[model samples]
Target: MTVESAILLLPWIALVALDRRALAGDVELSTLIEPIAARPVPGEYRTSIAYYRAVLALRAKDARSARALLDAVPRPLPRKRHAEAFEYLGALLDVVEGATERTLASAAAHEHGPRRASWLAVRAHAQAASGDVESARATLRMLRALRDPQLDLASVARWELPASRLASELMRGEEHPFR
Candidate 1:
C-alpha cells in the first residue's frame, strides 16, 4: 500500500485491537488507545485518525474526549463518503450526548443503501435515549428485518461501523434498549 494509505490503517488496526480487548473484558479500552493518542497524526491522515479516535472515545463512554476528537476532523473530508461518515458520527454523538430530536430528524432523512440500516440504528438509539422504549424497539425491529449481515462492525463498511456497533449493542439488550 502507498504510504498515505498505510498511515490511515494505523487507527483502524488500533480500533480493532481495542474492540477485541473490549469484548474479552480484559483491559481498559482507554489504556489500549493511549499509545495511538500519543502519536503525532500525519496531515494526510489527520481527519481519519481523529474520526477513529472519536469512535474509540465514544466506545469508552468518554463523550467529552470523543467530542473534542470529532470536532478536530476538518470539514469536507477528503472523500464525499468520509464527510457523510463524519456527519453520521456527529449525529450519533448527538444521541449519546443528549440531543435526540435533531438526531432523530437526521436519521429520518436517510433511507437507502448502507445508510439505511445505519440511520435506523441511530434512530433506535435516539428513541432509547429519549425514553421512548416502544419506538426504539420498533426501530430495532426494522433494522433487524433488514437482515443485512453487513450491518455489523466486523463486516460493515468502514463508515457504518459506529452505527452497526450501536445496533448490535441495542440488539444485545433484546429485552430492553441500551445497557
Candidate 2:
C-alpha cells in the first residue's frame, strides 16, 4: 500500500486497536471518553463510545448514569459487539431498574444463547438478592461450568470476575455482599 493509502487506513486501524484494548480490559472508559466525545463520530463508532461510557458508569456503581449512557446507544447494534445492547439493556433494567422477583423471573426465563453466561450470572445475583442462596449457588455453578478459556476477556472483565467472586463467597459460606 502507498503512504497515502496507509494514512487513510490509520484511523480505522486505530479504532480497531482501541476496540481490542477495550475488550482486553486494558483500557478504561474514562480515559477514552473525552477524545471520543470531543469529535463527532457516527454509527457503530458512536455505539461503541456509548457502550464504554456505560461500562464506566457501571464500574462506578452508578446504574442511573449507565442507563442514561445506554439510552444513547442505538438499538440493534451492528453485530460486532460482545454483548448486544438489547440483552444488556434487559439485564440493566433487571439489575438497576426493577430487579424484583418479576424482573429475575423475566431474566431467567429469557433465551439468551451466546450471552447465557452473562445473563445467568445476573440471574444468580438476583436469586441471591432475593434470599434464595441455594438457587443462586446452582445458577452460579451453571455459569462456572460454561467457562471457556477462548472467550474474550472483555466479557469476562465486565461480568464473570464479579460472578466468580460471588461464587467464591457462596462457597465460603458468607452472604454475597454485592448488590
Report the Cα RMSD per candidate: 6.7, 6.0
lDDT of 1: 0.62
lDDT (tens digit, per residue) of candidate 1 on 42-156 = 5545565576667767666777998998777766578665677677778878987789999988988886655787677677778877887677667767867887654532222
lDDT of candidate 2?
A: 0.57
Which one wins on lDDT? 1
What Cα-based lDDT does every candidate model obtain?
0.62, 0.57
The clash numbers for all candidates, in the given order, read 0, 0
Expressed as tens digits, the lDDT of each residue in 60-106 for candidate 2 is 77878878877666666676453454455447445555465765765
**Over 4 Å off, model 1:** 1-44, 152-179
